[model samples]
Target: MSSSNARTQERELTFEEVDAQIQNADLSEFENQDDANAQSLDLAAQLKKVCSVYKVVKPILSLVGNAPFLPSSWKSAVKTFNSVMSTICV
Candidate 1:
């Protein structure tokens, strides 16, 4: 086989190994549902700290909407920006 084909086969095996590892990963290490819920609450608090900064910056983004020469794509940009913020909150 060509060296390139051999390299491609090796890369495929590496990807399969990574996929298997990801599939086997779990939160079952946690003792119970309450333990998992507590960890999630902790994570939410951490994300809330990051989201506080967005609260300050979102008003700045709104200022962009007031620009006279805003491009047609400005709406799409605003939509995408809001989506990102919403995802972080979720």
Candidate 2:
């Protein structure tokens, strides 16, 4: 055989070797996707818990903000809370 042909043959993988490599890559992709899904679920659960607390606290803040001998800074803090709740709940 020519030198170039011998080199090419040496570099070529067998079909079974190529298939095994592909299968390994697919398995790794599945593992990565599982990790991604678990992280997504974790974030969703945390948000749900936070929003639950937001439901209880928002109206109390509103009531306190409206009818209190508080300073302007307290009102501003309530506005900040409202803005944050709007961002998160939507």
Candidate 3:
């Protein structure tokens, strides 16, 4: 066999080894996504508190909603913002 073929076989993994590597990668990806989701929820909670304290909904919406070609989701987000702002301050 040629030296290149010998090197290729040496670098190749068995089916089980490749499967294990793929599983590890998938678990790692899931863990990273979970971390990102937790961070997003935490940030949203923090922003909600800040908005409640400062009554920032109108200003926030004005800044973001005025952009051209806003999505339908943004319109729903605006409604949510309005609802959030409507809560009676303690």
lDDT of 3 at 31: 36
What lDDT does candidate 3 reach at residue 19?
52
What's the lDDT of the predicted structure labeled candidate 1? 0.55
lDDT score of residue 6 within candidate 2:
50
Q: Model 3, range 1-90, lDDT digits (tens) per residue?
A: 569645633553345544554454423322334546656667667565555443422334534544458887886787566556655322
Give the per-residue lDDT digits (tens) of candidate 2, residues 26-75.
23323334656657667778587566556445545555555458888998
Two-way TM-score contest, 2 vs 3, winner: 2
Question: Which portions of model 1 miss their true places by more than 4 Å?
Answer: 1-42, 83-90
Q: Candidate 2: which stretches are off by over 4 Å?
A: 1-41
What's the distance in Å from true for residue 25, model 2?
Answer: 50
Cα TM-score per model: 0.39, 0.48, 0.29
RMSD for each of the candidates: 15.6, 26.0, 21.1
Candidate closest to the true structure, highest lDDT: 2
Instruction: Please provide, for model 1 over 1-90, each residue's C-alpha lDDT reduced to its tens digit, 9 standing for 90 to 100.
Output: 569645743432343544554465453433254646556677667577557555444444544544448885895687578668857754
Model 3 spans > 4 angstroms off: 1-53
